[model samples]
Target chain A: MIEFKDVSKRFGHTVALDNFDITFAKGKITGLFGPNGSGKSTSMKMIAGLNRPDKGEVTLGGLQPQESKISIAYLPEIDYFYPWMTIKQAAGFLQAFYADWDEAKYKDLLGFLRLEEGMKIAKISKGQRAKAKLLLTVSRRAPYLLMDEPLSGIDVLTREEIINTLIRDYREGEQTIIFSTHEIAEIESLVDDVVFIEAGQVKLAGSAEDLRINKGMSLLEIMKEEFRNAN
Target chain B: MPTSRLGMFSKLYSKEMRELAPEMITVIGLAVLAYIYLFFKTHDYPFAVIGPVFMIGGMAAFLPVISSFKLLSREWKNNTVYLMMSLPVKGGMIMGAKLTALLSEYVLGTLIAGVSGFLLIYALNPELGQVLTSSIPGIGMKLIELWPQGLALYLTSIVIIAYIASISFFSQMVGKLVSRFSGLVTAVVFIATAYLSGKVGDLFWLNIDKQWFTNGINTFDLNVINQFLIINLLFSLALAAVIFTLAVIIYNRKIEL
Candidate 1:
């Protein structure tokens, strides 16, 4: 399980996460839904060991994120691969760093995502690059996968492909995925649990189905209702 | 494929070397042009090439320091710091690979400049070449006798370059911890570090100076010179290691992007 205990992080005068506390259950796809500046990305970064909390702690299975990085696979929202690398070359480079990098899985995902091995990262379309990022990330059989805004700025068709890939690759009892995004409706069916956050605090949290039934609204509509009521 | 620690390090080192190849190639190309120009000018003024030859040698020594300034900063510029920081390796491995690659560049650059200079001087002015290659007659030392001193000097130069590269790494890592005027901070940190290390190095040299002229003899002893050079080399290497370790700590604990 990944735990964030009373964690608070700030940038200058902006409060990114204010005494935020949450726990993402193991082996479940947890949706971290929030609007802009709601600290969704910050939460993911904390779990990935990319950001440090100013107060309190973040741990993965009793170990700090830095100590357990080998068990976590992180895919940031921005493009992070080297521009000079072709997809194949990037994979080759990354394979050396990750012991869990599955070449067969990578090859299968490359074809499924329709990404060419020879495609230069700099030359590829944004949607294609998104797919490439997903391919590299999912190729590793990490216990925890933290993907921040995986669907943002991607076209609808590309987003559908990504969602489909996640559904296909999720190792039900063995993997935990924490997805942070504003596109709640897109992954609505895939999410087992949901946490709606506003101003860096959990506004609503429950099983996806339970939340829908209790509110008699879609996950997207529930988020709008909650934010509107808060305002 | 499962990657061992050494295997991963080799891959990282190769990546750094590849990123630096363009600059290395450009320097080599310019040096070649300079050498070719000197070859033709040799007939007009035999000793005219001396200045340009030394200038090339200086450039070879200076290029890696320039390269070192960019090695870490460019990762942020390219947004590749995300990929770099997320890797499950210690801070030492990442910076170590980069340091090794920069040192390799220094070695290759200096060798090309040094060897080419010797060949050009030997071909254009054989008498000067003989004087340089042969030992001092008054000292009664042969060329073979001076080999250890030459080797010590070469190794010391390598250590000095490595130390500069480590400082560059340390300063750049410090610069990245801020939001504004990062480049200026890097420049200040670099200058401050270099100045402080030079002062510290002087203290060690002072102690060496006492034993430098052994047994109250004013004559130059090759053994003492070699000993001094080795101590200098080890001192610089130790300092570089210390600075490099500090940079790694900052990288692992403080840096966020």
Candidate 2:
């Protein structure tokens, strides 16, 4: 379980997260839903241990990321792999750091994504790089998978493939996945719960099915309504 | 147990060294190539006389700073800090491995220049054993012949690179800690470091007995010169350790972006 207890963060005078409190439970696909400047990426980065909260704490499985980094696999919103690395070298690099790295899973994902091992990350297309990021994250058997904006800047079919890969390869009751995306419909069917945030505050959060039933609309519609009301 | 843990960080060091290979190879290759060009151009001139200066002092000017900037700025510039920071390793280890790889590059560059310079000396004069304690006035030959001097010089270089890289990391830390006027803060820090650099840099050329160590070069006290160089190298290394520790603390607490 990942928990943010009264956590707050700031960049200069601007507060990125304000006295925020939330927890992504074990074994659930959660979406951090928010538009740009709404603190979605900030919250995700905090969870992945990229940013430290100025106030309060963030913990996964009752430990800080610095203490339990081996158990978390994070795919950031931006391209994060070295440009000079080939797909194979990139995988090998991860294999060295992570004890739970699954070589077979990596190979399978490479095949599924139609990516070759010899492909240089720098030379690859943006869409291909996205797939490479996904493969690298999923190939780890980490208990917590934090993916920030994993679907941004990809085409329709590639997004579909990623969604399919998530659902198909998801290890229920074993791996917990939290992904942030503003495009609600892209991950609507996949995410079990949703956390709606805007301007550094959580406007709405609950099980996806519960939100839909209570609001009498799709997650996308509820998202629009919630942020609009907050504004 | 500690060895295995270090092995993991060593793997990172190796990967970083590989990434640095291209630039390192280029500098060494170019230095050697330039030496060859100069040698050919001045066939009638003493190849051994000016070759060492062009290779060591000339080709290597400002290389430590350049190499440190390239190694340390990589993650933030490429957006790979996310990957780097997320790895199951402490910030110190990450920084250490990176510094080590960079040190390897710097050492290798110096070695290549030194070796080629030595070759030119040998080609001109086969009796290389006395080059270190040459009756002739040759600072370059003294460096290659005296192991203590060579090692002291190399250690000083390692410390220099360490200091530069640590300052760069601190700059990132300062930027994240205070986003407003970050540019101004960085500039102030850079200027401050530059101001103090000369006094600190004198550690590399520790000539307590100026004329005895340099000047005609043959009238130097071996014991005194070696001891002074050793003291300077130790001082530089300790300062580097402090800077690195501060960098690690800042990285853990305040480094963002």
Candidate 3:
């Protein structure tokens, strides 16, 4: 679980997150949906302890984000690995820091993703690199996994592979996964909860089915309608 | 089982050093080739014997300084700081790994250079050892004569080198802080700080000499030299520590995009 308490972040004159307050519960797949520059990534970064809020606090479970960092795995929108490192070396490097590293699961995911262990990450295509990053992240078996735009820029089949891989490999009872994506159709059926953000604030958040039943519209349709009304 | 923090730090440093191994080998090879060429061309130049040593040692010390600069800059350019910062490791630990790698490269380079220098000198001028033994008493007298000036110069050089390294490290830190504007700002700040520090140093030295004018001029006191070296060493270490601390604080608190 993660909580942001009146957290605010600013860049020069522009506010990236404005007094934002939200909580994400555990043991569910949560879809964080928003247009570009809607503070979705910022919120995720704060939760992962990669970025500090300018004011207030961001907490994971009962501890500060940094204190809980080892328990959380983060996949950024554009993940960058050490260029000189092979996929295996990268995984091994990560394995040292994390107690929950599952080597068998990592190998299985690598095979499923069709990623070569010896290939340098820099030599891989963007889609393959993204998959490699996902494999590295999910293999950690952390209690909370925060992924920002994991499916973006990948081929349709690769995207489906990624989605299916998450569904198949994710341990449902104890683990929680939160991902932010603009591609709602790919993740709509997979996510149990959804949080919609706009202009640095949470506009709508609830269970996916509840949003459909209460709003009387598909998640995408409601998002479009909300943005249209805001403009 | 989890690696201890220091063990993790060492592992990270080892990885960085391995990444830099190709460059290290190339530089060392080039130095050896140059030493051989110089030996063949001008056998009399003491450098024919010592050249390789100094070249290698200098490169060992200098290359890491240069390589670390490049490594840190490239991380910023590639936006890899985001990934590095997101990891569970402490900010200071990340810096420690980098500094350890750089220092290890420097030490290894120095050793290669030193060994090469010693071997070449022994091979070329085997009689140099006899020369030193015979001249020891006279050289001791000469050293006593020049002890004060020699000590001052040696201490000053050490201080200057430490100052340069600290500035370089600070430049990398500043680059991270300013991001896109890092290069321009780093140059400007480096120049400005260097100029200001030079002026302040001149003023401080003038006061020291002025206060102890007669003693400074008349005292060939070996004790004076010892004192000066001790003070210089302390000053250099303090400055390095402050710069390193600043770097750690910025790294720990500042968010990477």
Candidate 4:
């Protein structure tokens, strides 16, 4: 379980997270739906231990994020692999640090994603890089999988592959996945729960099925309506 | 599925070495080329090679310090720092690997320059070894006779390089802690740290015990010079350790993406 209790973060005078409070339960795929600059990446980075809250605390399984990083596999929206590294080299480097890395699963995903292990990450297309990021993240059987905007700016075909990989690789009762994106429709069927955020605060949140049944609208429609109402 | 600690650290060390290899090779390559040029051009004017060799030696020493500044900052510049920060290891391990890599650059750079310079000079004047032993106003000794002092000087140079690398790492981390103007912050911190440490070193020299040097510098004894080298070496190693620990603390606790 990951908990953010009264977390607030700032850069200069801009508040990235404002008195935010949320908890991601164990063994569920949760979506953080928000527009750009709504602090989705900030929240994800906090859990990845890349960012720290200025006013509050974030904990994973009662341990600080730094202490629990071994259990979390994070796929940032941007390309972060060393430019000099081929996918195979990157995998080998990561393997040293992550005990949960599954070589067979990694190989299978390489084939499934149509990525050659020898291809240099810097030489690949943006879509292929996105797939490569997903490949690295899912190869690990980490307890917490945080994908921050995994499909943002990716071509439709590549997004399909990424979503397909997520659906195929997800272990229902063992893995807790927190996915943040504005493209909620792409992952709507895959997310069990959704949290709608605006201006660094949760505007609404509930089970995906409950939101659809109670509101009589799809997640996309609900997002539009909720943001319109807040405005 | 578990990996040993040594295995992880070695992997990290190898990666750092690979990343810094290009810079090291570029500098060393320039030195080698210069040595080759001097090996031919300075046949008639032997001592003319001294200026260029000394200049290259200075460059070989300074390039690593410049490279050390980029060692941590480049990860951020290339956005690979995200990958580095996400690794599930203590900050000490990351820092240790990088420090060792930078130190390796210094060691390799200096050794190549020193050895090549000595060989080039010896090649130019084959009787230079004998000339050194027969001459010199006071210290009439062969090059081989000064091995003890030579070793002390070599060790002192390494400790000095380690000290400089540690300060560079410390100051770069300080620069990165800020959200803007990181380069400026790094320069300021580096200058400040180096200045303060130099003062500390001066204080140690001024407060030195008389026991080690009861018979002062008028004698010009080799043992006195060795002792000074050893003292400087020990002081440098201690400061490097202290500053490196501070860097590790900043990396683990304070730095943010």
Q: What is the TM-score of each candidate against the true structure?
A: 0.96, 0.88, 0.87, 0.96
Kindly list the per-residue Cα lDDT of model 2 for residues A129-184, writing each as its tens digit: 99999999999888998888888889999999999889988998898899898988
| Candidate number with greatest lDDT | 4
- The DockQ assigned to candidate 2 is 0.52
Would you list the rank order by DockQ, best first? 4, 1, 3, 2
Give the range where candidate 3 chain B is weakest over 10 consecutive residues by summed lDDT: B135-144
- For every model in order, the TM-score on chain A comes to 0.98, 0.98, 0.97, 0.98
For every model in order, the fraction of real contacts preserved is: 0.77, 0.61, 0.49, 0.77
lDDT of 2: 0.79
DockQ of 3: 0.56
Per-model interface RMSD values are 1.0, 3.5, 1.8, 0.8
Residue B226 Cα positional deviation in candidate 1, in Å, after optimal superposition: 1.0
User: After superposition, which runs of candidate 1 have C-alpha atoms over 4 Å from their true positions?
Assistant: B209-211, B214-218
Candidate 4 A-chain TM-score: 0.98
Better of 1 and 3 by lDDT: 1
C-alpha lDDT of all candidate models, in order = 0.89, 0.79, 0.77, 0.89
Clashing pairs in 1: none
Write out the backbone clash pairs for model 3.
Answer: none
Candidate 3 local lDDT, B116-150, one digit each (tens): 76667767777766654553452344434555666
Instruction: Put down candidate 2 lDDT per residue, B1-257, tens digits, no spaces.
Output: 02246667877898788778887777777877776765665556554446454546445545656666666667778888888888888888888888787777767777778777766655555555565466546333444556767677777777777777767666555655665786577657766765575566675456466665564345465776676677677777776777678778988766765
